[model samples]
Target: MTKYFLQKTLSQSVSVSGTGVHSGKQTHLTIHPAPENHGIKFRRIDLPGTQDIPALFKRVVDTSLATVLGANGAIVSTIEHLMASFAGLGIDNAMVEVDDYEIPIMDGSAGIFTQSITNAGIMEQTAPKHFLIVKKPIKIVDNDKYVMVYPEPCFKITCKIDFQHPLIGEQELTFDRAKNNFEKDISHARTFGFIKDIELLKKFSLGKGGSLDNAIIIDKDRILNEEGLRYPDEFVRHKLLDSLGDFSLLGMPIQGHIITRKSGHTLNHLFIESFLKNKNAWETGPTKME
Candidate 1:
């Protein structure tokens, strides 16, 4: 199965323009094909630096509001959605150029990035893609939240989320990348937060660009958005989507079954760090894609 895959990247350059979620500044992003082993990197053309930040778990310097990668004194924040798009599409190497410190949270979902990349076309390279084969179970716990990964034949996730809101209670979502379409099942699901949270976030200068157009805002027992929801169980689906993106920080595709319960970006980062610390739990080499 491992021999069947070759490294892949975009066939041509593609770009998008939007407003940064945190910076609240208009931004532009461009993607270009990179060498076989180049992997995914973010270049801050707006910043005075030459070191490109690598999209890897070790480079993660912060996971509070979003997954942030820092290297060479430069940092790129809010990259989970784009990273998930690359992982779902099996893109191996690409140079992502951003004209800002943060990525534009387009619609607060991976759908836009996924569709734009598809339009740019995907091209395979000569090198076989590498994957992290899970050999044993790895888990992380944060208060009542827990995330665990077990050995499996392919990439899959079983996620459970709970919210105090009426619209969102206890919800569970199970997804297999091989059987389920990432774009259809998870990519379009937008990020969500509470109305109270938006006010509190603004006090601390977070989610500056967040609005009903980008995020699903829930106020008490009602949704603030006029257009209901894309999926009835979109809340859990978005969590699953986030988990997929966070797990991609391992720097390669993963072959395992992930079971998570109310885990967020911080916990996801901790789990990845734990898995990498245990040298015998995973092996990186040529692995087949679903």
Candidate 2:
């Protein structure tokens, strides 16, 4: 198979250590190259004998605060960023080992993971790559929010967010994998939250490790980060970044155009479930590389 159409894994093991955004505890994650067809799986090294958790839609257990995967009573929380990093770079198989239940929220963006993986390099495997090619439009609507996907020759995303806040009223981004660079266009756009919601998140056992250092914090009129926004539309870009990671749970790349409006982890998961159940909407197989 052509290298571009073949599966890929990391060329060497890579590791990162930091604090969990929700747990507020230090955690270490290591990504190791895996054989073809192994797919991306996470092992909780902290809990020996627990079954490995596959990074697929069926494995997701929670999306309240972050995308969480669980199996055999073990879990790995806050995995979207790392999963997005792998998807953005076209990695198909790898073994992710973590010493904590949650993956560290490095800089609150996929930049750290993307850069580390890029620096270590990706290795092409013997097996051909597979893609979930959209055959017909599939849509999921929740009151005013929605997620939809249409047939496209290559992957593309259009995300729109409207918080109705004074600082961030509305933002939109259209990212085509054919032309956009993930690291430059989307990876650096950090996850953001409003100061007003911190207490609510804490009551849910989340956001305990958040700080200006890892995320963009907003007040009524301004962003509290010493350095300002990475892009004027970083909010929308980060939303697109999240959708990219959430969609990766399909267990393969996609050949489609995905559009989202005010979507979040929960909505994304709902859409995935609907998409899977409506099997006629998509087909799985190798796709030609352009």
Candidate 3:
């Protein structure tokens, strides 16, 4: 198999402004190009002391509702979707500066971030791309919920979600990263939540930025949104989207096929943590295809 790696970036810096999903505080996010090998770093501009949080699975300190990364005493929350956009678009180096702990939910999908990054254009850099290649199948399970990664030439995901709600029964979705169809097939699948869970989330002071605009609201029997689903299997597609973002936290593009069922942020992070811990199962090197 041939390896492939390419450094990439937006043509210029672009900023987006919105309210954080959990904090409910207005925040600004700026995406800028960084030097090669810099990977993706998040800078907390709002903190009294400036600190950088490397978007790595190891730095993940929390994965409740969203993924949170902390380093040098600084934390950045809800970064999975943004990282997914970067990974899906083949962006290798970026500096994500944010003024809050969480990124704006931004319609609860990766479409906006993908569109903005595309508008900025992709510029190639000289450095070779680095990739983590899975050499053996690895699996993690928590009861019936599980995630498994198997050797593949390129990044891919197969996700299945089973919800008891009538609006989203059982659905499965797949993505072939090398085909570059992320924007069309996966990006617009919005986040979703049950009506019964709203009050619970609020009690925990979470989902403050959530609304019909950013998430699909599912009641007992049907969807609460006037407009129907974006895709018949949107729920599963959104799960695949979240998997892409969560896996991107590996700090480099991955080469593997991921199979998941009823997995969420916590399970995704567990898979990554296990991958990192079991180095013998994988190896990283310069791409053979430049």
Candidate lDDT values, in order: 0.89, 0.92, 0.87
TM-score-sorted candidate list, best first: 2, 1, 3
Clashing pairs in 2: none
Candidate 2 lDDT over 166-278, as tens digits, reads 88888888989889999899998899999889878888887889888999999989999988999998888888888989999999998999999999999999999999999
Q: Between candidates 2 and 3, which one is better according to TM-score?
A: 2
TM-score quality measure for candidate 2: 0.97
Superposition TM-score, candidate 1 onto the true structure: 0.96
Q: Which residue pairs does candidate 1 place in steric collision? A: none
Candidate number that wins on lDDT, 1 or 2: 2
Scanning candidate 1 in windows of ten residues, the lowest lDDT window is: 1-10
Measured against the true structure, the TM-scores of the candidates, in listed sequence, are: 0.96, 0.97, 0.95
lDDT by residue (49-128, candidate 1, tens digit) is 57888889989999999999999788888999899899888898999999888889999889999999999999999989
Task: Please report how far candidate 1 places residue 217 from its true position, in Å.
Answer: 0.4
lDDT of candidate 3 over 1-290, digit per residue (tens): 66446688778998998888788888899999888888899998888676688888888998877888998778898888898899888888899989888898888899999999998888988887888888998999999999999998878889999887767778887798777588898899898888889879999998888888889998888888899799988889888888988998888887889999999999988888788898989999765763
Better model by TM-score, 1 or 2?
2
Leading candidate by lDDT:
2
Error of 2 at 54 (Å): 0.4
User: Which regions of candidate 3 fall more than 4 Å away from where they truly are?
Assistant: 1-4
